[model samples]
Target: MKEITMPQTVRGVVAMAKGAPVTLENIVIPDPGPGEAVVAVQACGVCHTDLHYREGGINDEYPFLLGHEAAGVVESVGEGVTDVAPGDYVILNWRAVCGSCRACERGRPWYCFATHNATQKMTLEDGTELSPALGIGAFADKTLVAAGQCTKVDPAASPAAAGLLGCGVMAGLGAAINTGNVGRGDSVAVIGCGGVGAAAVAGARLAGAAKIIAIDLDPRKLEWATDLGATHTIDASTTDVVEAVQALTGGFGADVVIDAVGRPETWKQAFYARDLAGTVVLVGVPTPDMTLELPLIDVFGRGGSLKSSWYGDCLPSRDFPMLIDLYLQGRLDLDAFVTETIGIDGVEAAFARMHDGDVLRSVVTL
Candidate 1:
């Protein structure tokens, strides 16, 4: 355990009400409790999940401290903590799996049911409790989290690029490499070309897939996808996605079709755009209001795995540092994902630009 010298309060972005603008407020961060650590955030990426929290799309939890994709230095650790210490550079992960959970017992910690967060709540100046989004809440100068959430990485890596591995980018990459099991000479098709989708395309390329097809309605997003490593691009606004994918794959469809959009229509497209016995990886998060209506016969006929990727089925401790190394080695272009870096004050504006389809990520560098 390390000695704690945490501040009584720090400036943080907070969502006070549903569908309302988030504001910077003084948040009281308590000293780390047992199994917890305090992190001095260096960089945090603005993700769709944060915007979802603001719009009440995730839940009714108000006064939310929103920001998850992050990289930082360890400021302190609490009692019984030894895996990390002060001054260690790390990437923050949302899933800090509990070792005693069923999934962990079975050696699948990525699916662990008991992910943890700091026992102490971060509060506003008025003592109002703020729910840290995804239990990370890194849109601040510092944040408290479970010690396991912090995955140590090389200090030489750019914080802006490394932080992205904490969420969207990791999910996208894992959707293809981990869930899709993309391999050399395989034909992979990714639906949606947002941050997650673009990373999936990159992941497919990294995994040595022979042909990568990127599908998106936005031409700019498609271009970004190509930059990431899509061998082919489909303009969904004017073309039939399934047909285009099939056409590119010689009428057999792709070996792995990833649905990064999570919409019912996109999921259906992914479902039908894979070859017989091909994998369908659903990495995009779908809202509760959305429903799927697939024929039972098709489910049997597909004869392949239909898997939903939770955080891209990534094990943070294993993936973060490895991906950072790949980025440093020039094999993975993590810098391409960082569209811009802004101060904490620019978060609200970043949220607006996110919808414009021009930016891949707006990182907040503290």
Candidate 2:
């Protein structure tokens, strides 16, 4: 049995107010309660979602404890928790699906309506309650999360790389393989060559896409897409994106078009940049004020599916370990995503670099 102990103090990044910069402050993590576990986080990726949380894009949850994409080792487990035990290497995920939820009951836990988080809350040293980002705040030495949130993976896998499977990478891969249902020899086009976009390209490759077209405004990101298995690239800034995609696919466009940009204009391009009956997957995060005014006639004329991917429509327990195995087997280049690694203190600057389109990921190593 795992021995329970007193609350522990650790420093974590916090966003105190909307649009304000983040700061490192001492946080008090209580022992895991029923069905919860404590993790000694090894590495956590800095995702744009964290930036959004800091900017008040997700919600008005103030003094938010940021950081989610993470890999760690189980340090303790609470009463009745049995999925993971001490010393287990694990990836932390937000979707700790409740087994009896509607989606779970329907055998589609991926769309779980009721996900679990730590039953107990971690707070500032001053005792102010903190809302953890995505329920697995991990930009610290330790974090408390629901036991189901931790998916055991290959201990040999690099925590920095395996941790990526927790969020953006999984979302992108799941967007292509799970949501988009990309099949062998399919022609695919992905817009926006950011972390999610690049991962989408990799997913397309892993799904055996014969001709992958990557579209982005930045030359650097386009180059990244090419390296990630895109067979062709389109400079959306200087080209008619839809026309270019059509030309690449014998004037019929790709079979699957992914909009990782999440903007109205890019989404419109994806809508028209696919063949009739083709699919369009939107994996990008869009602002609330953003709106799309599309012709109703086109919806009837297009004759295809338009879907938005949340967390890539993924099931962490099913996907994380398998992806990590692929990574360890040299089939998936998870390392390609880690552009740089930094200390916890380097997060703010890393955010700037991410905003500037400088890197795919900056991992925070403890």
Candidate 3:
């Protein structure tokens, strides 16, 4: 085999300043240093987080390369990288567990103490430093990341579909499976029918939820939710969501209520939509300024746990392969989530479509 030399400069979208539109420009992607890997990005999804980062919702890190949810083939590896090799297809994970954190010491490497990222800076064509989004910027044809951040998966699956499992899909699925512990015969209600919420509906169905109620303002999203295994749909724009969910669940409320929208109003709805001893899982990301005001008595009154799920409390090493296998077997409907396939240059337009709520996901195919 010939030694492959990656392009010295690759086209990537960067947010040069906060609250500004992302500009596609030539960026310098360096070779993998120690414990690093360069991935030949095959596909990356445009997520709300990238938009948030662009608007300075994430941090003051300007000149940021924006993208995280991605799937690709490992192009090269640095010294001491033994976990993956060139030619291996992979799904990028933000939570690259360190396995030596306090959480890991307690046998929970899922909450790694010291997750790693690329030590090298991928710069602009003019040699200005560029901060890769989430440390695995896949907006470019190629990106650099820590070796552990890339989890190998089945190459037979489409990169457009498999890349989604890297973020929102995994977050939603894990919220139901790992955080909510949705089980056979459980009555589940998902507030918000976006990609993550719809995946929660699917996850609940996969876990054998007897009645999966989908709530959303958009009828189209609800329809998509139904296709993803929602047993019932509630049009929040026309009806009271909590009451609608209660009526569907024999008036006792659902056994598991997942607040996937993250707003205080929706969180309250999720709080009130579940039966006693039922779990309430908050998988949605709320803005920092948003505050929740609930009765302390209600907190004690609720017998079950009220939990917040981070990235669906997922373990990338374990979930990625299993989900890929499920996708391959046609047991999980990953394809339904892909409403459109686009090129890297289509990211900005995809973001606009997302705001319009017209598509489930517009994946960027590199």
Candidate 4:
């Protein structure tokens, strides 16, 4: 592998501190060093995690470069990099699996504990070190990441749409297809019809689920869920979620219940809303302060699998290209996830829209 010869300076969105506004600042990106790559980001999506980082929900890492879901063209690759090259169109993924990790040795590379990022750092113009969000800070003109973080995809695909596969969309789709293993004719219920939940509905439909139920407090989200293949919709604001789900499933509950709203209430709803022996997949992320409590007997009596999906249990190398193909073939509507596209400076506004459920995703186009 050879290191790229040129380093460049670019503008990027930076969260200078917790609870402060993110600003556009000049960033100095160093040439790709061993096993790294430099990507000229075409588009990147604003995700809740980025907001979380900004709000200090993730960590105290200040002056953080925020944005992860992105698609870009590789500008150069560093020494020992063979998987991708300059000019290759790729989606950036946070998990860069290390084959030597224990999980990888067991053939579950998606659970790799030793994921890698660029050995080098992108710095503020004044030489302050910057933490790249999720190891793939992409809300910028260009970003540096591990070579393995760049998953090659069809260049013809819309960057705004394809970039989403790098995170939230992929997580939602994987929660249904990978973690839940939704099968044809299965009845599925998804609580919280946000981006991830809506994607779960689409994934369940793609997997041939017979009854796809979407539950959300917002009517608009339910509508989005319907467009994404939900056969039934339940407005939690006006209805009993578990009861509505059971009613839709002939009083037996669904075959699989996905809780995409990580909360004690929603988790309880999902736990009780699944039929006996039905699976419960928790794909929504919870804050550290959150805790769940259930009857010990209920846990044993359920006799079903309770699982948590990390990034939808997705193997980006296998899922990205396949999903891209589906999108290109008109089978998957990836474009539906992109509600708007904005310039890098609009990330803060996008964050507000995301919080208000005004958009599924607001992509930053470079």
What is candidate 2's lDDT per residue for 1-366, written digit by digit as tens?
Answer: 456689999989999999888999999999988899999999999999999999988999789999999999999999999889999999999999999988999999999999999989999999999999999999999999999999999999998998998999999999999999999999999999899999999999999999999999999999999999999999998999999999999999899999999999999999999999999999998888899998999989989899999999999988998898899899999999999999999889999999999999999998
Cα lDDT for residue 345, candidate 2: 91
- Name the lDDT value of residue 25 in candidate 4: 96
User: Tens digits of per-residue lDDT for model 3 on 1-366?
Assistant: 212456468889899998777889999888787888888998888888888888898898789998998999998888888999999999999989987789988988766768888898999988888888888888998998999999999899999999999898999999999999999999999999899999999899889989999999999999999999998999998999888888998888999999999999999999999998889999999999999898899989878989999888888999999999999999998989999998877888888999899898888888
- Candidate 1 is scored at a TM of 0.98
lDDT of 4: 0.94
Model 4 TM-score, all chains together: 0.99
Question: Whole-model lDDT, candidate 3?
Answer: 0.90
> How much lDDT does each candidate structure score?
0.94, 0.94, 0.90, 0.94
Q: Model 2 segments beyond 4 Å from truth?
A: none
TM-score of 3: 0.97
Q: What is the lDDT of residue 198 in candidate 4?
A: 92
| Candidate 1, position 277, lDDT | 97
Worst 10 residues of 3 by lDDT: 1-10
Give Cα distance to truth, residue 304, candidate 4, Å.
0.9
Error of 2 at 350 (Å): 0.7
Which lDDT value does model 3 have at 76?
A: 89
